[model samples]
Target: MARELRGHDLQCAIAQAAAVIGDWWSLLIVREVTRGHHRFEELLAELGISRKVLAERLRHLTDHQVLERRPYQTGPERHEYVLTGTGRALAPVLISMQDWADRWLLADGSLTGTAEPDSAEAARVHALRGTPVPAPLLLPATLPPGDGRAPGAASRPLDVVADARATVLFAYPATGVPAPLPPSWGSLPGAVGCTLENRLFRDAEPSLTAEGVAVHGVSTQRPDEQETFAAGEGLTFPLLSDMDAQFAAALRLPTFRAGQTLRLKRLILVVDASRVIRDVIYPVLDIPAAVEEAGRMAMKVVEGP
Candidate 1:
């Protein structure tokens, strides 16, 4: 149960927020739900929590408007828990915790975003191979002019991968386009290859399209910044701006702070047409090799079993 705060504690916003989600069980509940484990049994198996405890936590979260129950079946009257707007807003909190843990708990307390191939952060990313992406998740795209929509339009991952057999989605820190990168970007471990990665993908686009695969580049840069970069680079694909960190938080992607903002570490995801993550490439040691590997994995997914 959450602790009841008194007058002075009530005056602190942090205290109020913590009161709602300070419990270990409550925070784990939010994490599971954010990972798309909404059904009771799914949450139960994932969390390994007792039925009574799970029920109590779920009721507590729902009461606080963090989760809402929606009917998914009748007769027996089955329902699933989904995050409310308020709950969705907790993404940054979850991501911040993950970033902190990855940096301090898992690895040496370095400010770098990239990890070694054998690091715990790499293992966590590889474990996402079988995870299903949330169906309704969308990020604002930096579409080219005359696409029949206004600038900075939102694009769903499902829609982007719908017409293709597989889509190779790569995330980078940032690019030097309409604006210059942070001064320390060059010295950052994994931040050196954004422009190179984009160029490689741009050149590989035609062959990938021929193979029934699509490509998308994602970064924490704003839409205007991405738009300028896309045009200057003559990119053949879309550059989605996760300025709000929504996409990063949804996937729990590794991130590091740069220029007073969160930037995604270099990684790749090969998602199948069914919106399931088929393969994950993390700690991208070699930019060209990573792009080549993405193409290969995407083709393999297209080939099927």
Candidate 2:
């Protein structure tokens, strides 16, 4: 039986939340759901949990309103579990925990986003090559004003690159733009080349566009900050903000803390119109080379065999 928080503990948000999701199976269930595993069998296969335990956890989550069941099949009356608003709101918490584990437990407690080429982190990112990006994942975009669009608009990876043959989505730590970066930013490993990476992509935008390739940059920065930077830099492509870290959590992307916020590591993904990740470039050693490689991969995707 699960223990319930009461009295003074019930008044604390942390304690209350822990009481609901503190169980090991309960939290992993949420993580798996966020990763697009919806059906009972899918969760069971991914979690390797016993069927009886899985059923119990699913029922507990539904009773707590963290997860809701929707009928996915008729006649047989089968249902799939999905996150409720309360559960979806836990994205940041999951991402923060990942960041903590990556920094402290996995690595040497370094505050760097880039990883060694042969490192486990790099291997994990490389394994995403054949994975399908979730279609429903959308991030806020920093669009220019009066562009025939609303002031604050959200965009999905597929929708942004819908018209193009392929897309090069690059994730950077943060750019020193409308707002100044932390004083220690310059000294942090893998934190230096974001501005340059954006510039390189900006310079390559015209050619990439002509080749039916769309380019977009992503970071945890606010949309307004990205807007200011995009305008000032004369960037033709959009910069998406993962401010809530939903994108990070969905992909299990690596992150590090700086300036009191979680920032994505520098990496690139070549995604086709079908939302399949064709290639992944991590620990971006050279900014110029990575940009060139992105273009090459995008073109390769366009000129498929």
Candidate 3:
């Protein structure tokens, strides 16, 4: 019979591994870093982690060579934590844990859109399905002109990138504005908070603009209908229409079935002047908070490469 080791000092590999990352928060921090929440403020906001605890765990991981702190700002001395090679190697372990949770803990898919899934997440999804993960998706050089209104106009293809500003495209399903929602709209999978979400984005426009990020709302609604809603709400930003789903096809944006109508999932894409997608916010359950998140990401991009 084999003897059991003790005190996180066991001779076995699993015991040593547990000693390093057994804490729930420790592994979650790694997961967050893997998901690109590198900045201290970003991690704090996204993880809801207290400063003291986060600091301790980050120090622990840094000491153990799991993460390397890189300086991103100098005047105030700001830093971002990046996963070291050793840290990245643990991705499979996390992926396996996620797969187990997906099968048993999250069978109902309650965690579908809590965070933007990066390439590692994509790999995990494929792994769960026993398939090879596809390569990272590349954004198109430029967006096609899609049907929409520019604040009190009819449906037409609006040139998305002609202005050369970093744009936040907040896409939703049909909104309950300018027209009464269809009877079962709320019951649809991704349509519950469609209007409220857009309202949140609109409210955050001032803050986003302060950061030099232009905010635009998007949906499958006709240009005329969007125009009415924008005018009624006194929205300062234009809402783009993709009624034909042409833009959807170009980006292969995710969607959910809403009876006969396919509704765009709640997605926020931070697109830069170069027409490159810089950041993505998905599964936006908390609409108002998502605007703040988008702002942070846009600023991060503006900060550097």
Candidate 4:
């Protein structure tokens, strides 16, 4: 639905804020920009907004200097349009909205029951004691709080280790657990593996191409983590299985400091041709930093005799 402009005075803060964001559609537009989405057509597809509304909003934002555009390609078909500095600055707002939605809006919810977590203390105590609360702790299911891991528990352990060489090994943990590193992943190779992804497929493919090398990221969407690489557009590598998240836990990746669900922390690895370690970067919020460092290491690995 098109948003109504509600205001009488320009001096009013609420009215001014509304004038800027003003509608559900505009706010969503800003969100699309922050998620590394730039091209007008791409944003249109992602937001699914009508052309009339999108064109109007884009014009409005451009007028307010909230976004700046640049050309990407040209010829019989000239393609251009990108988010400028102002548009890039909207990252926090989008991130905040995402965080809020994660809390109030359910990623996946059923008619189980709607209620906030009962006890924050209950959550911590179970974690601190190395005990696993039943699925009902977060999920409303069979009760009986106890260690989620039991002796002779039948489960595959995906083992990952970043050695001193900055290389990482992905193996089944049943064999052995690798030793700890020097307390930093700065030494590992630059690589990013995306789990099965429906949304950011294009975003994850750049990690393999020479041009995509620095901004490089690989997706592991396949069940077997099969490897694939297209020269430019599609993903260049296999995706981490999204099935059970065994690959994630093997790396001992932690998604949030809160010790929440079994979400694997996003990671970047840099591997040598011989596949020796160089540097590893985890918990990267700034993609440029992570990718650049990996790129630097990759170049060094190539240059070394």
Estimate TM-scores for all models.
0.94, 0.93, 0.50, 0.36
| C-alpha root-mean-square deviation, each candidate | 2.0, 2.3, 15.3, 20.4
- Report, for every candidate in turn, its global Cα lDDT versus the true structure: 0.86, 0.86, 0.63, 0.39
* Lowest summed lDDT window (length 10), candidate 1: 154-163
Model 4 has an lDDT value of: 0.39
Task: Write candidate 2's Cα lDDT for 119-191 as tens digits.
Answer: 7788888988988777677777776445676544554332333457898999999998888889999888888
Give the runs in model 1 whose Cα sits over 4 Å from its true position.
150-162
Candidate 4 Cα misplacement greater than 4 A, ranges: 1-9, 76-79, 107-305
Clashes of 3: 0
Worst 10 residues of 2 by lDDT: 154-163
- Candidate 1: residue 92 lDDT (0-100): 80
- Number of backbone-clashing residue pairs for each candidate, in the order shown: 0, 0, 0, 27
TM-score of candidate 3 versus the correct structure, residues matched by position = 0.50
lDDT of candidate 1 over 1-305, digit per residue (tens): 88999989989999999989999999999998887788999999999999999999999999999999999999999999999999989988888898889989988898896999898889888988988777766777776456686645654232334357898999999988788878988888998888999999999989999989989888989877887788788887888877766777777899998888888999999999888999999989889999999999999999999
Query: How many backbone clashes can be found in candidate 1?
Result: 0
Distance from true location, Cα of 301 in model 2, Å: 1.3
